[model samples]
Target: MGKHLESDGPSSFSRDTVKAIISQFLGFLLDAYDLTMILTIAPVLAVVLFPPSSSLLATFNVIFAYSLTIIFRPLGSAIFGHLGDKLGRRTDLIITVLGLGITSALTAALPTYAQVGILSYILFVIIRIGVGIFAGGEYAAGHPFAMEWTPYKWRGFISGLVQGGFSFGSMLTAAVLSLFISTFGVKGLETYAWRYLFLTTLIPAVIALAIRLSMKETPIFSDLKAQNKIRKSPFLDLFRKPYRRDFFQVMLFMTGLFFYSYSLFAFVPTILEHKPSVFSLSTANHIYTIGTVAAFFGAVLFGTLTQIVGRRRLALIWAVITFIVSIPMYYMLMYGASIGNVAIATIAVIIIGIIAQGPWGMIPIYLSERFKASMRSSGLGFGYSSGIFLGGWFSIYVPLMHEYLFKSIDTPTNVWFSTAVLLMIGAVIVGIGQYLGPETLGTRLSE
Candidate 1:
């Protein structure tokens, strides 16, 4: 009886662990929803703010602003990651959530371009930067927080739950936009739709803040601190020695994953919406909604698979599947034969979502396992943020390259074809990197 009780204790689920996972998941959901909400409104904003004269340029400017935010994310991660490592995860999570909530609310209240001229654009950029800083910290802090609290056997599931939040957030944003657009009309949508979308950020952010406030520091971090084993300069320790190879491996892994994700999630919907020759706005929205739902289950599936096969092998499989199927997926979406064709296209979109997004579910576990608990937050933050920064730029540049090189918008098929090729290249790199990377299954935090 004593032996059975002792054995079961390690696998038992506790209230604190559940709380930590929910808090982290909620924070991720808010961030994901806010980021995608602005993206959904970008087309309408371009017409309103830039009109016909500078519409494309306005769209590019918004993309550039988003890219800048991605650039600053690493800085936020570094700052908050250090604090989380040195002080406590709960404290850093609270700070980030509060900052994100304030900035999101402020974004909703900002003046339009007609009302404030260049100042409106300037303020928008500034707000995005503020949000970016907090967003950067939110992601880095949450993954490690959840991973630390979770039992080793269930880490993959918890990690998937954290990753799955973004897809759920995206779905929620889609549902909200669908409702708002139906009731408000396009003109009303242009004026007030974005404000409501921004307002949605407050719900999860405030909830996460409250939940985090009630939580204690993880046992692993606390134990390390008690032993005086925490690194004095976590960033320096990551880059200077012993950890550099692992850092590079993380960068490679993230770069490939981010490249696939940012392109598919951020660019694909916009491309489909703006290019009516391919699909109407309503059709595009339906596709996105369906695709996002598919991605959510894909993440959950991949997360479960990781627990059985190990992170390295699962990542390799996802990459290979994406590379092989991307062209057919793009082809179906580009040229639908009938209503049945649209159904087929929808399935293709779902498969693409699964392949493109599966890597993310495993990344938190793979990254967290690579470092000692004392420096895990900092190392993972640096790796993840750097990949986002690089991948964000790739997403921006690829479309610009398509426009410049092809010199025509009339050819929707070519544009999508180009996008698929770019994604395939990223997949190949990910597959190769996984082959070269180390397997980190069943590793303990103390290692």
Candidate 2:
């Protein structure tokens, strides 16, 4: 620590380090904000795209569209991850942010079913696909870029705080949605207010782009170029020998991370709204916002702990805690909602959010440290995004598994048990992955 401090100057966080962190945070925040806008208004969009009588199918369709974005992210990761490693982090990030900004603007202006029939839904799906590609590239480039700038001792703090942007962005969406609903009423949301939801991100997109423009190339990447060690194919390089093992292990851990995220943070609001006449939509949104708030802080706390306790130990502890508590934690959520105890349910959601999502705070640095600089950008981005291939589909699998297991979707019973099982499954994978992967707590970025 002292040696790194001496080399990096006395302070752990310099002005440039802070700027890099903030820039990447804002980029990630905007990414979440844009992607989540679809979910915030998914029910309404479903109605506009399909016949209201077929509410179930319409909802499923919108979800499929959303999932398409996840499934297609690897293409972006490969393409942008390659660019990032080959060209530089700053250039690749600028391209991604700009692509995202344009796609978001396109989504905001898309035609509705009333105007263009099936074409409307088709266009919306296409735009979401575009979003997935850009969003995939975003973390692939931005994560490594920012981590490369961080001082060794400060990695945990930077990782946790930067990753917290996802929750902050989701919460930001809830806040903006609430404001618009008040101003325009639910009627206004369906008519036109929803456009602003997508359009609103344009401002932040520009701001993030400006930040990327001002940023310098990461020192490690610059040095790689100076030494003529830039890999000819960064994405393909991950498949070679030693890095191949690191690639899959990180991918496994990340798959569990995505599963944990989708299971709790993504499913809660839907679960609350599905309960039998317990919470109003407004109350449910409030609960979601609170959970996200807790989740953001939880990530920072756990991430900070990872630095002290070691990543493998910290992750194993959480994995065990999650496994033992999954059933009870979910039961509390169901029990509180069923009994109309919003406080009980809200508290359950908060605890679940912290335990489940907090460990992600260590991801940026952990993944970066696992690979050398030559493959760092591609390895980090592709591995992180690759998890979506399996883990991302867990949300879809829960309902199917519930229907098969319970022999009844006749009620909300499926939610409590099925979700608990899936959450535990994901947590176990996390434990195994962390245990098997190398402990990287004290490693330098250039290691």
Candidate 3:
């Protein structure tokens, strides 16, 4: 630890470091915006894809559309993780950004259910799967690239800021699309508004590309190449000795992260719009925007704090808080809505946002510090993404848990009971997983 320790010296704030951070932050912002835009857009798309009478199926179909993207992410992680480890993070990241932007832009040209029946829905599903793949690839390359460039002393802060881009992206998407839908109303949403909204997805791609073109490979990756330490068949190497154990442990931590994150994000809109009366899409979206703004701040705050408390310890604390508050905060949200009180709901969202999202800020550094520099990208990419196997199923699990809890769906309850249960499960997994793992705070990356 003493020999490998890094100093907060001049090289810590080098030009390439700044570029790496900027590229990842902006690139992930694009990832979250495009991927999550489908959630707001899905409602409008349901109109074009399903018959007027298909309500239950319409909602299920919409949820599944996004789920397909989430589930397919591992394949992309595997493919791109290998590329990042072998060819280099810079090249892998460049390819993935272009792919994500192109795939996102293609959604605007897709035909509707009325225009081509089920064929239209199939086409949309194909595009979303493409999105899932590239998103996974971006995750593989982006974090390692940035973290390797970061100084050890500020690793936690940089991790938080980079991962916080996801929160910022989510908030931005809600603000922009929510306002767009509010301006047009439901009918206009079903008309030209939806397509135009999707067309705007190209902007992030262009922005990220300009930034990446100017950036160089990290100092660490360059060192590895000079020594010829880059692993052949990097993805397969994960299953070999030394790396495999840490790889799977980080996978569990990531699973817990995704579970709580999806629970917080996927269903809140339904609660805001349908359950609580006197709330419409316009007002509900404001709540979403405000809540995510809180999340971005929460992430940065926790990231900074991890520099003090240590990553494993903070994760234990946050997971416990998330479990404890899960049911009560949601109850408050429902009660606030039932009584036509927006203030209580807003408070619930803010508290929940902070406690729920803080671990995400810590994880970027935690995972990056866990693996050796030689296998860092592959280990981080696949280990982090493999969690989706079990964790990403919340869209399906929510309904299943709702039925298990109530024996039927309850309008007032939504999936609150299930979400609470899900949070608890996530709490236990992350709490124990991270606790049993190494505490990587302030640890320097080593080849």
RMSD of 3: 1.9
Best by TM-score: 3
TM-score list, all predictions:
0.93, 0.94, 0.95
Candidate 1 lDDT over residue span 61-150, tens digit each: 676677777788888889998887888778889999999888977888878877877677778788988998898888777888888888
Give the per-residue lDDT of model 2 (tens digit) for 238-282. Answer: 998867988999889988888788776556766675645277656
What is candidate 3's lDDT per residue for 1-33, written digit by digit as tens?
A: 552457522246788888888888887888888
User: Ranking by lDDT, best first?
Assistant: 2, 3, 1
Candidate 3 local distance difference test against the native: 0.80
Model 3 TM: 0.95
lDDT score of residue 247 within candidate 3: 79
What C-alpha lDDT do the candidate models reach, one value each? 0.75, 0.80, 0.80
Least well predicted 10-residue stretch by lDDT in candidate 1: 1-10
Task: After the best TM-score superposition of candidate 3, give how far the Cα of residue 152 lies from its true spot, in angstroms.
Answer: 1.9
**What's the C-alpha lDDT at position 366 in model 2?**
87
Q: Candidate 3 has which clashing residue pairs, if any? A: none
**Candidate 3 local Cα displacement, residue 262, angstroms:** 0.5
Off by over 4 Å in 1: 1-10, 54-57, 276-279, 337-341, 405-414
